[model samples]
Target: MTTWLLYGATGYTGKLIAQEAVERGMRPLLAGRSKEKVQPLAEELGLAFRIFELNSQTAEHLEDIDLVLHCAGPFEKTSKPMIHACLKAGVHYLDITGEISVFEYTHSLHEEALQKNIILCSGVGFDVIPTDCTALKLKQALPDAVELALGFDSDSGISPGTMKTMVEGLGGGNTVRKEGQLTDAAIGKHQRLIDFGRGKKSAMAIPWGDVATAYYTTGIPNISAWIPTPKAAIYAARLLNAASPLLSSEKVKQPLLKWVEQGVEGPNQEQRARSAAYIWGQAANADGVIKTCRINTANVYDLTVYGALEVTQRLLTGDYPSGSWTPAALFGPDLLESLPGSGRFEIDSFYPGNAN
Candidate 1:
């Protein structure tokens, strides 16, 4: 009956996940560190609740649960113990984490899950799903893809929790794979101007774990995609990124992150009024035949909810393939092509690399 565990049932994204679990006609084992946080919502949805501490014994917790939907995140902190519990209990698992550190750490467990036949997937949200989908589609369109560029733009608004997480990533060094080798880049240093249809904008190079995974999955030699940002905002981030190193001195990163988190939550009404995300992709082979396209998302955090709903449904009904995997690897090219074209943003492509 897909008796899933709804970990982090109390956060912004977690609530949406809880809502989805109920709509699926399943009473997930709604859980968190405090019964108080999850209980009120559990009552609203007519679902039962269970308290789960970070490192507590879980033999009792895993007794009958078939799988776990780890909605709680900043996965670097919570993934290990919960994963340990699941592995010990022989329960299958899944989560929505987008951090490279977290994904790399989880990727390390590949053999472990394979040995036990447990399914572990990270970035079930906006992190790499749409990006991955588009990348796969390009590969299909171009049989021999040599180098790739993927950009993201969305008119999406992020909630506090997402901001909190993004803030946590600030100034920290992030690595991406290049020519099958690892290269480290700071959060906002690598900036570029991009066109998102709404207007000309700038994007920063953040360590989006997708770069590493996509390279590994598709065998693409060169890859990079710029994230969406208004031109002015891009320059602003460039400035901040320049200062990120200094701000990130071991003693200062946390306080700065805390400040940024507050800004996300308490932005002026105008700041909150406009937000977005957009994804664009490029691919080609030795002949220089390149395919280019874009995916537009209007709201950032909300899409996480939307993508999660789609992925969870796929997971629940077995719509997805079985494996310890990533979003791009799972959803693939065809599904992305099938995504409905909308007014806010469109994922469309053209080929012209050979002409130049």
Candidate 2:
């Protein structure tokens, strides 16, 4: 009986989640800014939908909704309004956002969410679920952990929304959680060879959402997030950092944004089926103890659809607590393995002792 809404239900990932919801026999009212896109999909799926822009009047639409799965993003721009509306409407808020700023913004409203008795959980997707869970599991393994490193590599092609988010991030440099605080760092400043159960692949630190969520989830003060990157992309990111100011300008960003809008939607069915994601995480303490773990899962996009629906179903069944939460924190570290095609975390190594 939990009435929920799926916003941005027309986007690539959004559509996937929406379709999966129906296939699971769950009905979530679909919503988006464009009626043309939202209505057609709703009609095709035989589901109800609403069209509304993010504005002062947004909460009015959530009046009857118990939860909102906000799939629209560039969450840096889209999240604030939806969060505000959710708070106003006393609706639990969930989103498939991997943006650090969005995580931090939602975390800032933790008290308000607790007061409203509604949960605000974000990154219920490939973005931070695998990484966040890995972080927590490692922390649980090494209780006194002070440093955390996380990385992932996925073969799934990018969606337009993801590409836009990356284009927008060109100017923000990169960030790491240092001494329990978010600190700016040069993009690709830190590199390491991580064996994500396959082989040693070169990874470079990037501003992943775990930089924000993992800190809250595991209380690890020093955190770094990474992704496998080619030497050329690393060099390009360095150059992009040097030209950060220009990239921040609308004049420079608009064309790139337009290109993304006109380009590929995302991977097709074949690509989704063919792709896979690998994640690696480590936690270490000053005492020289380290715990390393890794997981292999379905394509990032496919996991997003599964993760989002799983979270939605759980919340509807009264499975999580109220307040701002990372996906791992709300569902525990085994959440990733609970999904289809996502296996249990393989504790690859333990320094000086048993991981358990």
Candidate 3:
């Protein structure tokens, strides 16, 4: 009888998670900043609803829940308050943020969560599950790996929430891990042609959460994560990098935020059903031995629902270690095997001295 609470239950992605949770016969208490928004969804799903701004008072609303699935983001602003609330209430906290800063901040709470004896897991979604598991599998294949590269391509459409988050960090630059340290690099500084078992596509380095999560998961000292993009987008990113000072200014960013507001909510069911995602990872050691693999998963949004729910259910079963954890770190590499239609292929040609 593990009762759960879902914050930000009115957003595009949050709605999807709620719908899926209901379909699976789990009733989560819906919560958000606006009772007007959450009330309708809660009524529609026949679940309880609560309204509370994310702050010190948030814990007061968590009286009856065992866990909280935080869907609110840009987590940079929302996570800290919600996490503090969860810590104070002694409730497990989980989130779907891909923001590396959020991950690091949450990880910083490991000792506090352990002291409270509650699990604190983040990136329990498409953000890093597939890539996190793939990175761990590659590490298993190349146990002595010193460097790791991971990339992913998704056909899923962007939600307004995702767009807003991306826009907020427009000129932050890309990040990569070097010798176990996070280093900032100019956007579009590293581009590669990655073949995700489908075909070659142009991929550019991004400050993905895996750069931080994988370091803790496998202890890989050097890591990079990429997302496929068009050539024009790469060039545009470079231009933006050069003009970051202007583009990042409030004068410029304000208009961009307005533009993003008019965008679509996210992929519709038909679009989500038609979409597919692919992930690739390579692990190499100083001696030149490399192990590469590709993972083919269903739609990104759909996978997010699946991954999040799976983690939620696992938490409900109890006995998990208390700490901030990445998906692979808590569940292991084979966790993806439970995902329907998810397949992994290890390239036999990727081996010692191949260097390709």
Candidate 4:
């Protein structure tokens, strides 16, 4: 049997992925820090359950599993421990991590996993898939790109869990790749207004973890990512960024997570309605001429589910990268074709009028 491990199977996003797996007739081994939480989800989904609290015994127990869906995100709490356990078990590992620190940290495990013949990938979610896939697509049209700018905005309601993830990212350390070297960047350093097709809204260079994926996936030297959230959100995040000095205290983050968790009223019928992200790629080839392409998409949180489940399914089929890798490096431009078009992804290419 092709047994799978659904880590954090009880979390918000985890449950959806678990449901998807069960529907496919694959009963993954549901795992979580809490056995009580995992048991019912597995049973309800007609899957097996195993509680693994990131302990040595649990890590060893993870051995022999075909692959793991590392879904318990806000991964600062769960990712590393689970990865170490999966590495020890020699199992393939993947996660929807949107934090650069986690991605960088996972890359640290890449060489080791390769030597051991295991697979590890992060940001298999909306974070980089849309951005990464779109970048590759642009590269297909324009061979060499100097900068890639992504703007994602959603009118759709976000799961509090996803919000907590964002809060964690903002409150966590900040980063960007500069001069071909990885370094830290200030939070909210880049900001402006973005047009999401529907309307115009404020956009902030929120320092998404995608900076890492863009650099590694496309040889593009200059990359920046922005999220266009409502103005209220802008203020809240700015407050968080301004208070970064205090965010380091778990005393602060823990309560903040609790607060965000309380904010989850669940996506409404219209709330889950639709959302999108737009990525702009600017290229400069041998000449100094500049060209641009716009990559836009809708329903991003749902897209996260789509992309992540796609990767998870690939893992089950034994169609995946062998070791630690980013989604772009693993999936390439093909990922764009996989997205539900018309609503999910749209690429518009533009050039300066008379520059030809």
Candidate 5:
């Protein structure tokens, strides 16, 4: 049987994935930088475990591992090292990352991954799967699509790791793909009323991973992603944008990160069971033709568990193409519907009244 390793196996989302993986009868080697955390989980699950920080010796640890499902983040820091190690070791790489830089970086390694005959798939989680798939679906519906917009809203709580990643991204403000290039937009500069299957809500464009991945998935020249935001948070985002340097500083970020560490563990079981996430996307062509789609799924973290494992199970079969790929690029838009709690995509196409 093909075997794999689960790094960051003790994290909140990782623990859920680990437990579910065991319940599904797979014995992945549990791993993380901290033996204190990783070992206990391995013991509890009765699975093999390993401890190793991301470093030059990382590839040495993958000798017996066929694939790696990396749950560690902020992946902007953690992904490169593991990816380098995976490339060297000829092991397939997958991660639940939604970070734009990480996705672009991994995409840069596409040729190397293809050369090594190992798949480098990122954003396997809620990060981009639903939106990425939506982008593809929209593109398919309107083959001439030149523009894409995607937004998601959820009542789910954030994890400390995710919080830290967001903090680290404060310096980036907002980003969107414009005419095939990444363009920075000021925070709160791009707001839209998106109906994410739950009435129209005010959403602000953010530096979502789809600003990178959706372009790759759909070959659309323009793209943006948004999330519902209140007026107060929008004001704060604008202030943070002006204070980007402070947020980028370790001295300034440490305290906030520490608070997240102590106080934020992400949603509990009940929250995971009840919370749902909605994704909305649209594509437009020069002719003013529009295509739209929406997906409702389990909470982002819960979807991550299913999405990661779904990709993991498929990669284990050794049937997927070997190259860096977004989920939609690898599995088609249907992959989103395949998730355990995902609702079928609701799609519509029409010509705007303003169309010439």
Candidate 6:
């Protein structure tokens, strides 16, 4: 039987993934830095549990596991050690990280992973799974496209882990792909009225992982990622860009982190069931030909559970290419279509026909 380990099993999102795994009759070994938390959950799920800090010893625990579903963050700190362990143990690696730096770093290890014949995939969650696939679908609709714009509206509450990750990057501004290079852009640098199938909504450029992953997947030279935000928040982001020095300081960031700690772990089951996410993408060539696509899916957190487990299950079946890969690159855009309650549409345009 293919066995996997669930690191950071006690986290909010980690717990959700664990529950989904159990519901699907999967019994992943629960591992984390804390026995107090992981032990209870493991017992509840009737699975074995292990506790280990991310270090040289991590490989010892991976001896029999085929894959690791790393859910802990901020991945900027957690991913390196775990990745090193996975590579050493010859185990496939996956994570739910939206951090662009994390994606870039993981991609840099493609050769190492290929050498070991172990797949390394990140951003399997709400971060880029939907957006990355949508970007590829748009690229298919416009094969000669040189520029791409992606947008999403997450009508769901933020989890504590997600908030902490966002707080850690407050002063770094946003990121966008220009001429196929990842470059910093001012927060709120670009704004658009994206028609997310529901209606036109205000969206602003953000340092979403797709700014990096989309380019890697499609080879699009210019790309931007956006998220729907209220007008007031957009204005605040503009001002925050000017005050980045202060915002990025520990003195200011500490209180914000504390404030986030007081927030809920994440959305409740009711909220997740009722909420929804909308995504839009457009690819264009120099001649002004454009191809657009839209995706409507369940709530962000809910989709995270499905997306993460779906990828995990697929990895368990064991025939994936060995290298750092984007979700779309590994599974194709039709991967998104397999998710329940997910829908995608491509607009008919005067551009080239669909590549797929």
Models, CA RMSD each: 3.8, 1.7, 1.6, 3.0, 1.6, 2.5
Candidate 6 C-alpha RMSD relative to the actual structure: 2.5
Please write out the lDDT profile of model 4 over residues 1-356, one tens digit for every residue. 67777787787777876776667666778888787788777778777788766655667777678778888877877788878887888888888878777887888887889877888888887776877776666666667666666556556667767778766654554465665566666665666776645556777675676677777777777667776766776666657776776777678778878887776654643554454555544445544545545555546666676787778777677566577788878877677557653233344554555534
Q: Tell me the tens digit of each residue's lDDT in model 6 across 1-356.
A: 88899999998999999988999998999999999999999999998999999987788989898999999999999999999899999999999999999999999999999999999999998888899999889888888899999888866888999999988998999889999899988988788788877888788898889988998899999999887777888888898888999888999889999998885578899988888888788899988787878888888988888999999999988598899999999999988878876986656565445453
Candidate order by lDDT, decreasing, is 2, 5, 6, 3, 4, 1
lDDT of 2 by residue, 103-202 (tens): 9999999999999999999999998889999998998888999999998888889998999898888688889999999999998778878887688887
Error of 3 at 287 (Å): 0.8
Number of the candidate with higher lDDT, 2 or 4: 2
Backbone clash count for every predicted candidate, in the order shown: 23, 0, 0, 4, 0, 0
TM-score of each: 0.83, 0.97, 0.96, 0.86, 0.97, 0.96
Task: Score residue 263 of candidate 5 by CA lDDT.
Answer: 87
Against the unseen true structure, what C-alpha lDDT does each candidate score?
A: 0.68, 0.91, 0.88, 0.70, 0.90, 0.89
Pick by lDDT: 3 or 5, better one: 5
Candidate 5 per-residue lDDT over residues 128-184, each given as its tens digit: 888998899998898999999998889998888899888777577889999999999
Cα-based lDDT at residue 315, candidate 2? 90
CA error at residue 257 for candidate 6, angstroms: 2.1
User: Best candidate, lDDT-wise?
Assistant: 2
lDDT score of residue 339 within candidate 6: 86
Task: Give the lowest summed-lDDT range of ten residues in model 3.
Answer: 347-356
List where candidate 3 sits over 4 angstroms from the true fold. 345-349, 352-356
Q: Model 1, which residues run further than 4 Å from truth?
A: 186-189, 197-199, 230-246, 249-251, 256-277, 319-322, 335-356
lDDT winner between candidates 4 and 5: 5
Instruction: Write one digit per residue (lDDT tens) for candidate 1, span 113-194.
Output: 7777676777766676667776776777776888877767654456666666765666775465677665786555566776
**Cα error of candidate 1 at position 121, Å:** 0.7
What lDDT score goes with residue 251 in model 2?
A: 92
